[model samples]
Target chain A: MPGALHRVLFVDLARHRSWVEDRADLYSESLGGAGVAIELLREHCPERCDPLAPENPIVLAVGPLTSLYPLASKTVAMFKSPLTGNLGESHCGGRSAMALRLAGYGAMVIMDRSPTPVYLSVDAGGVRFRDARTLWGMSSSLTAGRVMLEREGGAGHRTVLRIGPAGENLVTYAGVTVETYRHFGRLGMGAVMGSKHLKGIVIAGNGDLPVADRGAYQRTYRDLYTRAVRSPAMRKYYELGTPENLGPLSAMGALPVRNLQATGYGTEPPLEGEALAREHLGRRLACSHCPTACIHLAALREPHPEAPYFYKTTFVSYDYEPLYALGTMLGVEQPEDALRLLDVVEHLGLDAMSAGVALAWATEAFERGLLDEKALGGLRPAWGDARVYATMLECIARRAGPLYTLLGEGVDAAAAEYGGDSYALAFGGLEMPGYHTGPGAHLTHLTGARHSHLDSAGYAFDQEDMKAGQSRSPKELARALLTEEARRQVLSSLVVCFFARGLYDADTCVACLSAVEKERNWDDLMALGEDILRRKHAFKAREGFEFDALRIPARTLEVPTPLGGLSENTLREAISEVERLLASGERFSHG
Target chain B: MGKRLRVVDVERCVDCLLCAFACARRFGGGGLAKSAIAVRSVGGMERGFVVVVCRACEDPPCLAVCPVGAIRKVEVGVRVDADRCIGCSMCVEACAIGAVQWDAVERKPVICVHCGLCAQYCPHSVLAHEEV
Candidate 1:
């Protein structure tokens, strides 16, 4: 390995001290990202430690391929989630991986909570915990980002990961926003930051790396770059971005509408991707080293309510998940309304998926007379009412009322506390991602490490199986999903975007790893991936996670997917298969 | 063919820093420290980006300011004589566009040779190899 890849930076927020340590052994064995992170979490996190306590640690790791390979731009953030009260891992892309790699570290372990609100600035000069007492209560995360950007000043190469009011309030599902567009948007990473009184993290670096074999490096780099830009897999992302899935998903009757009460967007033109792009696409952006500029910014131009003949243009990012969560799930029918709601979510630095699902539950609860006007704080729960949703989003972020406080804990906790557990859409403590494809989608969310769709990409499996005109047995499907998730451990450890999985297959990943690190082969990487998966599960199990005790919302069986309503028996059988697969992972080792 | 790299579209640049990486690879390394080209956002990325590179100026300020006669005007762009140079960075200071990037490790100004290596790897075509 290059000497740089072995370095780990440790930040003690309690002591306000920062130091660097060279852990070549750990890097040599784990190869960074989730592989290294799981180990770091175990070492630093005390057994039965409070998820919000100072004893819990935050691990942000980048891989050997980071800053050396194209599209290897994701940074894996691992911590014990306060929401799930178990293993928490989230991956974000922007300049995060590159910035960390350039800032002269392979991984960073932040522990010990700050006594007061503070933000960590990491540049070539090393880590400095700056006083952020004044910046703490800023209304929106965007303003907070702007303040940090102006104060820190790395501009293009720097990544500012900051949280908003939601995080500051310790909203369980709040996320740490990356570069204003991307996020470590799952598993309550922001709440962890908030609990430490750590408001944000800033990283900037200009240094580069040394490739062992330049000839092979260049050849492989060119091949990956060419494929990333020119491939058909990336074309849709480049054109309309992830929102391109909006049309197809809606047409296929897989797009969740009105809290999964409906599965399709019925005759709604504004909710479609093509219509939104044509009407509102302002610009497109990409994470560092990624050719596909999948982050689509919609220019929402609306007339200023107070000023005549004046209009305000707000650039809001739109994607399939957020569109489904904030738009369709909340019954937001108009594009502008959905965009406005998304703008609120982004401003508050809340996880759009979790927040949307929580609100969906609230709306249903309100309509069913379980939640009255007193609980809603004068806001009525009505379908397609963006105004009501907007006010409720603020209330939840602030934990303003009895209902909002409960909802702030996420859909599972909210429903459990408030008598709507059956309708709550969360699979684990974490809420469901925007996929109503079939049994595979729900099964993946339940069985995957993070309770996220990206963990196993079960929706893709559903689409593929549908195209093949066949459905596998529950056990067979479990094997396929688990295989993909296991292989993805390599990708996440290398910290590459999941979108580029086709380009960075196991062999290609091994080739890339060999160029950057020493004493590693394809077999070692495969074993390391399996070991990482086991370690993550071990962490979860240690923290009281139970596979058999996993909850599949009753509503999941009620909603008719594209393949019709999923059978409970099949979903339960899939979970059983997952348990057997995980038992094998326990025996796997990194050696 | 004497091809010079040009910032064809600043708006199209995603600030990926691939061009910078490509330039550094010419010296058998990875990083922006030795690269002559620099891509930075104008305050914030949502606004846009600014791609800083040598314009291959007529009667360049860098060549004029070199006290030891280390820099010479080449066919398309200026080249630095590392042997003759005292690393004064007068030439770097002379350039108004801030295209004269300083190598922190070597303590010398790294100027663009207009080799057009950066243009080839530009995925978005933000940079172009213009044939003069």
Candidate 2:
């Protein structure tokens, strides 16, 4: 903690009271970002507390490398999720990390509910709670973000973290949008913010961070920049962003389609990255300190239904996950329709992955006669109907009816309530992401901490393993996943973007840390990563989340992947082995 | 050779602010205060961005208007002699690009030294050094 000056800012919305506390102990041991934030939540959040209640603390923390290093620009938000009913952690990149770190604070904790709508503004000097009645109840999240951006003095210096109507109305899976594009897009963090009557948080700081060795810092910074710019991985991200995955996934017949019932969309038109770039890509965007401007904005041109000469062009950003979830996953063939649906979910502040999965479930349910037209409020639930899906998204955000309310909770809960858990398309309550590549991908979803594909990168593992014709036993696969997840704790603790994994290997990470802070060595970093992973697992266990209780949806086995038929029993056995390995306290070194 | 500052093109700027960081790095400082140039979102980033810095005016109102004779033409651009400055507001108001940043801690005007160091770091062709 010699390097980290831990400052925690606590805001009480109801009384408009705010104070700062320096908790050096948290940072000294756990470091910051996800590690420290998780510890803070465990200490502050009461067990069995209502996730959206005032008692539940919403904690946001930035890692030590934030603002000082490139691609380490993510802020981790930790709170009890209204949707997941367990430990919730979401990583978002935008101005959040830089602004928070620059504002002279390591973490922000919000407690108590506000009597009326309000937003918090934190700067280098001080913090203020501004009344947001005028900006409240806005349907469009973009409008709310714009209002805060204009009203706040830090035009380019601050991040405007705001929730849309979905959050305002307490949609169970509502996410908080940051910088208008990036989001804490899972586990109902926005709903928690809304429950506290907090609409947004704007942060700006002009304070200079102290470096132990300026010369070394400068040298390393230059070296990292050169590596980042020159790396082929970085180039792919820069040119096409994440949407580049669409083409390969589709080619391999691994793109999730029709709620995991199929892997390919039977459309003649090429709905891949090349086609998207040719037809729709308008601009590219980058997160703070990221040289790879991978975020592609698609300019969707639409003619007015009535007027001949009144065409309008709107820019909607696309990534592989959003495209998969809203497009092929929902059997949406038209790219325009997919973009429209993406726009709707984004505008309403719903998690695009969860929303798409929920829609797919509803469509399947309606088709199977489990849900009828009456249940859908006379709105037909069909795959590829963009107009109806867009309207349904609105209904979901508003919680218009019983069905919408259930759908808003996410696919697992919705399917459970509607009787389709077998085809729910969820892993541990959170919906599955786009990939359906092979056993590795499915197993990763079944066992990864957040049930996110990014966790342990099972899809990447699958791709590599397939090429090599290498196979792992259940125990070996579990060990590999757990080891990778453990190592990633170090990365996430630094809060670096996972895209820079190749660049920031253990050696490089240690070098960078030593150059700046000079206290930690490689061994210490590895041990810290393992400890953090254990702590996360402990938290999950306390919340009744058992690695054994995890369910591999029947549909995963029923539908044959391009690789082979994956068995659920094998996945479950793997989970059991992982549980044993974790219990044994055995550590595996990559080298 | 006196120091000179240059901006290449406003339209070409991606607004990554690598120049700003590079300037800060050149000074061996870890903050934006050391940077000579600034980039701000114009209206919103969706619209575009504006990179602001000293254009180094020919008449140089900054030099002419300084009562304490603190402002002078340097190799990069017009710079305020930090030792000679009286923390007066005269030159700050005179500069067109609002490049004369105030160091509240030092109570002095931080005028651009126009070293073209920022231009070297601009990955995009938004900033360039030129001889007059």
DockQ, model 1, C-alpha based: 0.68
Tens digit of lDDT per residue, candidate 1, span A1-591? 322877899999999999888888887777789999999999999988998889999999998888888888899999999889998999999889988888788899999899999999997667988899999989899888878878986532588999999999989888999988899988888889999999999998777688788877887788778888888988887888888787778778888888888777544534787888899998888888777888888999999989899998888998988988998898898899999999999999899999999999999998898899987898898888999899999999999977898899988888877888888999878898888888889888999988889989999989988888788899888888877787889889887889898888767887776665553676767677777887888989989899888988888898788777788889999999888878865432221
DockQ of each: 0.68, 0.48
Q: Which window of ten consecutive residues has the lowest lDDT sum in model 1 chain A?
A: A582-591
Q: Whose DockQ is greatest here?
A: 1
Q: Output the number of the lDDT-best candidate.
A: 1
The worst-scoring run of ten residues by lDDT in candidate 2 chain A lies at A262-271
- The candidate maximizing TM-score is 1
* Candidate 1 Cα deviation (angstroms), residue B91: 3.0
Candidate 1 lDDT for residue A98: 88
Question: What class would a CAPRI assessor give candidate 2's docking?
Answer: acceptable
* Model 1 Cα shift for residue B122 (angstroms): 1.4
Candidate 1: Cα lDDT at A191: 88
What is the lDDT, from 0 to 100, of the residue A276 in candidate 2?
88
Clashing pairs in 1: A208-B31
